[model samples]
Target: MRRHQLAIVVKEKEYTRRIADYIRGSSFGDRWQVSAFTHPDACKQFVKQGYGIDLIAAETDLLRELQPELSHIPAIALVARLGEADGQFELLQFQALPLLLQGITDQFEGLCRKPVKGLAPNTNGKGALVLTVHSASGGVGKTTLALHLAGVASARGLRMLYLNLEKWNTSGLWLQPGGDAGWEGEGLSELLYAIKSGSSSHTSWLAQHRKFHPQLKCDYLYGFRNQEDRATLLPADAAGMVDSIVKSGCYDGVIVDMDDGMDELHYELLMRADRNLWIVSEERSALAKQSQMLHYGRQKYGETFGRIAACSEVVLSGINSELGNPLPAVEAALAPIALPLVREWRRGELHPVWSSSLYRAAVDRLCAYLLGESEESRIHAVG
Candidate 1:
């Protein structure tokens, strides 16, 4: 038996046709059986005839009229604009057709107890694992490691998305050949807007906006193109964006190259991530900054610190194998994963060189750890 049925009840024929067209062309159409009704009476009659309907989206007035009969099914009221409230169904003002359909689908899925077909069942019900690479000090090769980890994971057949949240990102220079040509659409700014406006089509929007990096063998969404756009992004907005991306179920792992400095959004992401890699350099200033960050996190977060600390790992970059005294406070908090500095890295090359070096082995170990695979298991399989 088909488990999902979507009924569209609206007064206007044009609106019904438009919505139906959008659904047919959307991801939802492949997974759902959709029906449209132009009259309230017709919809009620269809329901009265004992037809199975899992979800319904209707005009505000029609939704109110049919609420008593269709109270068992999940319903969403389509409003002309924002600010009007409806107690019956979640109020969604019609905006972009894709977003509208996505909003309705999200609400329907939440209300319907039965699982919908075609959507992958979240094994743990938390969706994808979000991994964040962050640092309080800059120039510690955070982006390099983040990209390498993502690339290695993708090569190992894990679906991954790399997101650079820095204010000024040179990801284009490294990931693409042309360097930001013909890729000038809204990108993260539009995504941020979609999240802020409570748009339901965040996943769809992301799918449409994401660009593939051939060399990295993974997909990525560009960060804010300009510095001016960075000011508008709030911490909650960033958190919401990440949540939507994870809930989309498009990737097995999402790697975030976070900006420097301890902002609310950065902390929120660290708290929410499945694993947080704090990259630091061996330089005195970088070590001092790392110590300060640790102290601040413990003092400010209190009990939440334990949860974040449990999932956190420190990686010390640009280090040579030498007996050097390190900060006791830093060393005690977390054992650092040592990533040796690569000579090719100084040439400012865009391509990744992971296949033929010790750095590659280090990155592979990191990847294995993130994927929860034991080194012994991997070795045994090889043997």
Candidate 2:
């Protein structure tokens, strides 16, 4: 990995110190050099002098002021607080992607953003890995798969994240009930508001809590809580947030849980994901939904959709047939219909107490697959 410096741009001395301290105090500072700027003007001067910066942690207004001179800099908003009134997601929508792309574009202007500095030629490999998990039909267990994949990767000691892109499922299942134990009103909704409003001390405000599972490694950013919040993360904004995380270099792999229903946001994510999983179930409805989704994907992406590199079918909650127990009278009723490669999961096989473990295994397989490994290839591996 190429060493990249973090340039902190803020006007106040105290604020600059706080930002510096935040970096020095975190895992990033231990390895990367972090510098502070008390004024936007000074930071721009540093950039003009060809003192390159790989990342910037700054305020939104402060960032805008430096945009012209620091146009080439990669940045992430250092949100100050966590509250619903802040419009955190909205802020992420506007700033994240443009800033990262700006940095990349600046670095590779001669090559048209190609060969991004410190990356392999012809390879957009910025050491950033993004994975998307989606099912055309609900109840096929995409969330379960996403959650478990994060756990397994984390267990293998890889820095990873699980992001749910649907408000209802994200809040109801992943963030609300499951993520609230250690955190206080902090979920995707709260995170979005925090960043947008530019409060203070927001690090802990965005992390999701979970029961321990050794195999999966990750953090999480849940989807919107309702139309109100979703409205904040418009298509452009979602793209920006994703770019921020990718440029942050804080994660090795980002697993996004896409909604089953087709939408502009979903389509946008499908374009960004390095690996896309099209999960389907044996149910006829699921098959119908998958067919429609596949049609849309192929139509929109052309041949690229076929060459997406990683695409698979995951059959979940299917029937269990014991050996020599006589097959079900109707084979069609008992088996998953013409499933592609499969990961069979049955509630009956898992103990209630091992729900977390079961979840971890599924996610582990997912991470392994994303990193270009087969399930039988390794007991444990980290990207």
* Highest lDDT model number: 1
Collision pairs in model 1: none
Model 1, C-alpha of 77: deviation from truth (Å)? 19
Leading candidate by TM-score: 1
> How badly does each model clash, as a count of residue pairs?
0, 26
User: What would the TM-scores of all predictions be?
Assistant: 0.65, 0.53
**How displaced is residue 95 in candidate 1, in Å?**
21
20-57 per-residue lDDT for model 1 (tens digits) = 78777777677677788988788889978888888877
Q: For residues 245-268, what per-residue lDDT tens digits would candidate 2 score against the true structure? A: 555444555677777766677767
Residue 376's lDDT within candidate 2 is: 75
- The C-alpha stretches of model 2 lying farther than 4 A from their native spots are 1-123, 170-186, 190-217, 222-227, 300-369, 374-383
lDDT of 2 at 8: 64
lDDT over C-alpha atoms for residue 158 of model 1: 59
